[model samples]
Target: MGESPHAVTSLPTARQAGCPFDPPAELIEARRHGPISGFTHPGGKPGWLITGYDLVRSVLADPRFSSRKELMNVVDFELPPAPPGEFLLMDEPQHGRYRKPLVGKFTARRMRLLTERIEQITTDCLDAMEQAGPPADLVTAFAKPVPAIIICELLGVPYEERGSFQAQIETFLNGETGEEELMAAYTATQQYLAHLVAAKRAHPTDDLLSDLTNSDLTAEELQGIALILLSAGFDTTANTLALGTFALLQNPTQLAALRADPALTDRAVEELLRYLSVAKSFMRTALEDVELGGRTIEAGTTVVLSYNTANRDPERFTDPHVLDLRRQDGGHLAFGHGVHQCLGQQLARIELRVALPALLNRFPTLRLAVPAAEVDLRPEIADIHGVKSLPVAWDA
Candidate 1:
C-alpha cells in the first residue's frame, strides 16, 4: 500500500504489534523502550505516542499544543479534521468559556444528590441480575444499564427513549465512519437536546437538563453541554464499572479488603480509574511551532495525550505498574489535569464511590465466569479502553 495522502512524513513502517495498549506492567515495559514513540497508524500520518506521565501532563497543560485538528501535529485513523461540534474538540478560551458554567453542576454537594439515584439504579439492576441467575454478562446486565439510566435521568431524557439513544451513542463512537456520518450523529444529538431543552423550558424540573434549559446559555451551548453530559457520563462510568469489577475479581486480596471494610472502596475506585485509565487520551495540537524533548512540533501540530501511560509513569507513582487500592496521591492523570480537567469527574467519582461498595456488599459471591485470558479487550477505540463483555457468576 502506498503512503496515505494524510501522511506528511515517513513514520515507523508499523507501530508495536498486538495491542498498542495492554496491562499496566506491559505498557511500562513498552515505555522503557523509548520516550516519544512513533507508530504507523493504518494509512494515515504516523502518530506520536507519549508514554510518560509528566510529558503527558506537560503536553496537556501547555497551550502551545492545540486541540484543533486542522493544525495537524498528530493523526488518528488517517482521517481529516473533524468539524467543530463537541466542546472537547475545541481549544481553550473557547473551551474554557463553554466549560465554565457547567462546573456548578459537578460540585460535591450537587453530585451528592446522585448518590441515592445511582444506588437505587444499581440495586434495581442487581435485583434483575439475581432473578436471572448465574453466568451473566455483567456489562449488559449491570455495568451498562445503571449508568445509562442515571444519565438519562440526569439529562431528563425520557427513560423509555434511552435504548435508541444508547445505540446511537455507540455508533457515533465506533469511528469507522467518514466525517459525514460522525457529523450527522452529532447533529442528531444536538437536535434531540434542543427538543429536550424545549421540553424543560416549558416544564422545568429538578435536573441538569432543566438547569441547562433555564440557564442564560444559548441553544447551541446548552445542546453541546447536554450532549457531553449524556454520552460521556454514561460511557465512562459504564467502563469503570465493568473494568473495576474485573480488577476486584482478579485480585482477591483487593476484593476481600474492600469487602472486609466497605470504607476502603472509595480509594479502590480511585485506584481503578488510575489503573484502567479508561478515558485513554485526549488530543492536543500545537498553537505555534515549538520544540521539546528533541521533537519539533509545528504551529498547529496535533498530539495525543496518553491518559493510560500517564497513570503508570514510574517517575510519578512508585510501583506504578502494580494495583494498590490503598495508594495515596494516586498521582495519576486519570481524570486529566489543568484547566480542561473533566468537569464531570466528581460526579463520576460519586457514582463509583456509590456503586462499588453497594455492589460488592450485595454480591459477595461475585466471581468471573470466564478466565482472564478469555476476556475481550478493545484498545483502538478513541479516548476509551473498554471490555466488550464481562462475564460473571454468583458462585457463592
Candidate 2:
C-alpha cells in the first residue's frame, strides 16, 4: 500500500467493485508511484509494469524491447517461439515478413470501402434485434455477431462451421475456461485453420485468408495468420461495442451528446476506446539492459504495458476519467503503438463508426435491463475485459 515510486507487487490488481470501467485501483496507484514500477510476474519472476502513457508508448516503439515469446523471462522455463506466422510476437525481419505482405490489404482506403458493407451488417443485426424484441443479451444477440460475421466472412471461414468456430474462439480467448478446455479449444482451432488453409489453397476465394494462400506462406504460417486475424478481429471490437455502450449509458450526458449528433460518432468511438481500453495489458521483454522510466530493465526482463491505465494517464488527457465523447486529445494507446500496433485498426474503426450509432438510433430507449452493478463482467484475468452478458432493454 506504500506510495513509493519503486513499489512492487503482484499483478494484475483487481478493479474495484461497481467500478468496471476504471483501471484496477492498484494499477492507477502504481502509475502515481511512477510511470514504471517493479513487479513480480504471476510465475514469481521479477518484472516491471509500465502504466504511464509516455513510458508505455516509448517502450512499445523501442526496438531493444522484444515481443518474442521465447525471450520472455516471466517463467523459469524457456517458452517456445510463437507459432509460425504469429508475427506480433516476433521481432524484425520475421515480423516484417508476415506483416508487410498484409499491410496493403488492410489499408485505410480498403477499410473505408468496406463501410457500406459494415453498415449493411449493422443494420441486419439491428433488424434481428428488433425482431427478437427487448431484454436481450446484447453480447450474444448483437455485439458478438457483428464482428463474428465480419471476421468469419473475411477469413473465409465456412458458413456451416462458423458457429463452432465462434464458440471455440470465445472459449479460448475469454480466459474464463479451464486450462484443459482452453488448450482443447486452441488445438481444435489450429487444426480447423490448417484444414481451412489447405482448402483455400485448392479452391481460393475473395476473402483475406484465401488471398494470403496464394502467397509463399506455408500452410502452418497461413493458419497462424488466420488464428491471429480471427481472434483479434472479433474479440477487441466486440468488447468495445458492448463496454463502450455501457460507459455511455452510465454517463447520460455523453450518451445524449452522441445521440444528438451523429457527427460525433468518430470521436465518440475513439474516446470510448481510450476510456474503456478493454484489451488491458500486453507483455514485452527487453533484449538487453535498457534504461526506461529512470529504471534499468535488465536483459530478458518482461514488462507489462498497462494499456488501460496509460490511456487514462492524467498527463496525457485532461480529466482522464471523464468519458467525453468529444474528447480532442487523440494519441491514445487503445490499439497499441509501434511496429506491433494493431493491423486491423482501420477495420475496427469503420465497424465502431457504423455499429454504435446505428444501435443507439435503433433503440432510443436503450438502457441496462438489470441494475448496472448486477451486470456480469468477465474476470480481470480475461485477456480482454468486458461484460459477460449485457442484458439491455428498451421500450417494448
List residue ranges in candidate 2 displaced over 4 A. 1-4
Provide the overall lDDT of each model, using Cα atoms, as 2-decimal numbers.
Answer: 0.72, 0.91
Return the number of clashes found in candidate 2: 0
Instruction: Go through the candidates in order and give the clash count of each.
Output: 9, 0
lDDT of 2 by residue, 187-218 (tens): 99998998999899999998998888879999
- In candidate 1, stretches whose alpha carbon ends up further than 4 angstroms from where it belongs are 1-30, 39-43, 73-85, 174-190
Candidate 1 lDDT over residue span 1-396, tens digit each: 222212213222121443323444434454676545553433455555566787888887887776655555444534454333356767766776777767887898988977887888889988888888898998889888988888888888887878877876866764455688788886777677778878888999878778766557777677767777777888888888888888778789988988888778778888988988888767776677666556665564455556776787777887876778889866678788887788888888988888788778878898889887677764454456677788898864
Decoy 1 TM-score against native: 0.86
Cand. 2 Cα-lDDT = 0.91
